[model samples]
Target: MQNKKNVTLLIIVAALGYFVDIYDLIVFNVVKKQSLQELGFTGDALKANEIFLFNLQMTGMLLGGLLWGIMGDKKGRVSVLFGSIFLYSLANILNAFVTDINQYAIMRFIAGIGLAGELGAGITLVAENMPKEKRGYGTMIIVTFGALGAVVAGMVGKTFGWQTTYIVGGGLGLTLLLMRAGAYESGMYQNLLHNSEIKRGNFFSLFKKWSLFLKYLACILIGLPIWFAIGVLINLSDRFALAHGLIEKIDIADSVMYAYLGLSVGDLASGLLSQYLKSRKKVIFVYLVLSVSLMFVYLFNTNVSVEYYKYMCFGIGFGTGYWALFVTIASEQFGTNIRSTVTNTVPNFVRGAVVPITLSFSSLSKTMGPINAAMWVGLCCLALAFLATLYIKDSFSKDLNYFEID
Candidate 1:
């Protein structure tokens, strides 16, 4: 009973940690234009700077993922959790006071570094500690609860103004730090820590073997469409609406709210369905197809009413609802020693894929226009994800109590 209590408490901490992570993650998308305009960026400068800041933040995550993932294995998941939250919480508070674009970018990059650690560390702890048969549900609860932070971001970003939104998000993270006090380390991680003979947290070792490299690459690939949709389709929906000749303007925050609302429902449904079906690949395959089909619908049609366009955003978000399952698969794929590294780096790499994705979109837009550029870029992402899904092994019933060798 006490063990179960500890597990429950750990899940609660992971869930709420992820909640703040998502809030800070999505809040920038919600307030990008308002905040940028307030800093005096107008016309093409606004669009260019938006991409710059967003990509810079993703770059921070790319680096931070490596930093925290290595630390999660070498030190412990609990320490990474505390350290990451503290760095990001302080950075977020500093974000409220930025008076120029450079300051804004610096704070965002710092906050990104801090934000990168939360989900991977939290998920690693939950996965290592939970029973194999029920870990999917555990991860599902964290992600579903966490995704709601985007909805709250939409509300708070709209109601509280951009500066207050940053303050509120940072405050929530600091408050959650108090609750992190009750969390315990993963038993698997703890056991691995005592065995100095076992190799752990070597990021370069993944590249030493062909099969290992491919598996790691496939894990990252299967998640590309998720970020592409959110990063391009939903985040830049306003520009798309203008290109489509739609009379009504799209509100960035509302689109994110509606889409994430679908994402929350989709995550819940996919989690239950994966358990019932007892296969991760099948659920992911289905969601990937649904997302791709909706992307075509979203791009091909110009007759959609503003309300209908928002519904389409919700549909696309629902279709890509395998976010938690994707991370869970990565967590289950490796040994306890390097599992945190794999889990952390895979998601952020996909997020960082947005750098190339948005860059490609921008370049292609100059020649073919934004709608067609998005369609082509999205198709490429979807195709890669589908093929990679076929290539990687299903980890649903795999044991994770082993170590990776050097």
Candidate 2:
């Protein structure tokens, strides 16, 4: 068993690592318009660039998810955690020096790759270290604190030049690495390391079994609505609000800020709710329903002001707050051998889902307009998410001292 002091330190470091990961992940969204406008994009070109860049970043995350996830199971979670932060921090600082769109796109992609490793590695570490009954609380505290990074991104993006904002985020990430020097690997992983007979970090093994493949797919689908809510409805709130006939211009940064504030609250509440209910599935179901309900309200409601739009952002964010619980379920579903791989890839794949989700929205918006387009795409995602939730087994209180077999 790990010492209480070390476990606590690990959790704190993991939480802060996630904080920086999220800040870099979301800072691009906050500064998208400003950054693009400075590069001479205007009107539709600006929107196009934003989506393109966002997708590029998500693409990087998608690829990075696989790389870092494999590395976590092979190298150690702590290595991936700090390694990812270091890569993204360096990317962010370089991002501040870009003079053209191509340079910006490249940086976003690099940063996305770097951002991919933090949460899964962090959650897996904390989850494995804590006791089964209390592990939810440990993971909950990490995500609840970490989700606030989006709020900080919004504030800093609003107050500083886009370049300065990127620099600040980079600086924060580098500073965070210093605090991580004392972090150690989980006992489960350490044990796995000693058993050379056991195959570890095998990504292809997941696809070899039909049931296991379904389990992996279910974990990925269960999280689709989260990214849709954040990546589409909130990130592009200005477009949706305008389509709904609001004359007042909405700030994307403010929308992201308020939604993340709600997300922070929601994460804390959902985490506590899951612990109290003692069932991860039940909490996920509740939040999914909330997310779907808010999606309807956000899409269909025609009458709204700036304040109402922001409130809707918060409501949607709160509804999607089951993010940490969703990731926890994925971490618990697999064994230690492939646990890090599953944990890391699941959330990033969910984040990566934004690619298809946004692409669909972009295509549909060309004809039906942004509101109805988001409605259709969001419906598809939510329906898939609900089904995925049903498909996956309840994982609360599952013992983590096992291994997947050939």
Highest-scoring model, lDDT: 2
Q: What range of 10 consecutive residues in model 1 has the weakest lDDT sum?
A: 301-310
Q: Candidate 2: misplaced stretches above 4 Å?
A: none
Per-model TM-score versus the true fold: 0.99, 0.99
User: Candidate 1 residues 17-112, lDDT tens each?
Assistant: 999999999888999999999999999999899899999999999999999999988888998889998888899889989999999999999998
- Count steric clashes of candidate 1: 0
Find the 10 residues in a row with the least total lDDT in model 2: 1-10
Q: How far is candidate 1 from the true structure (C-alpha RMSD, Å)?
A: 0.8
Measured on C-alpha atoms, candidate 1 has an lDDT of 0.92
lDDT of 2 at 32: 91
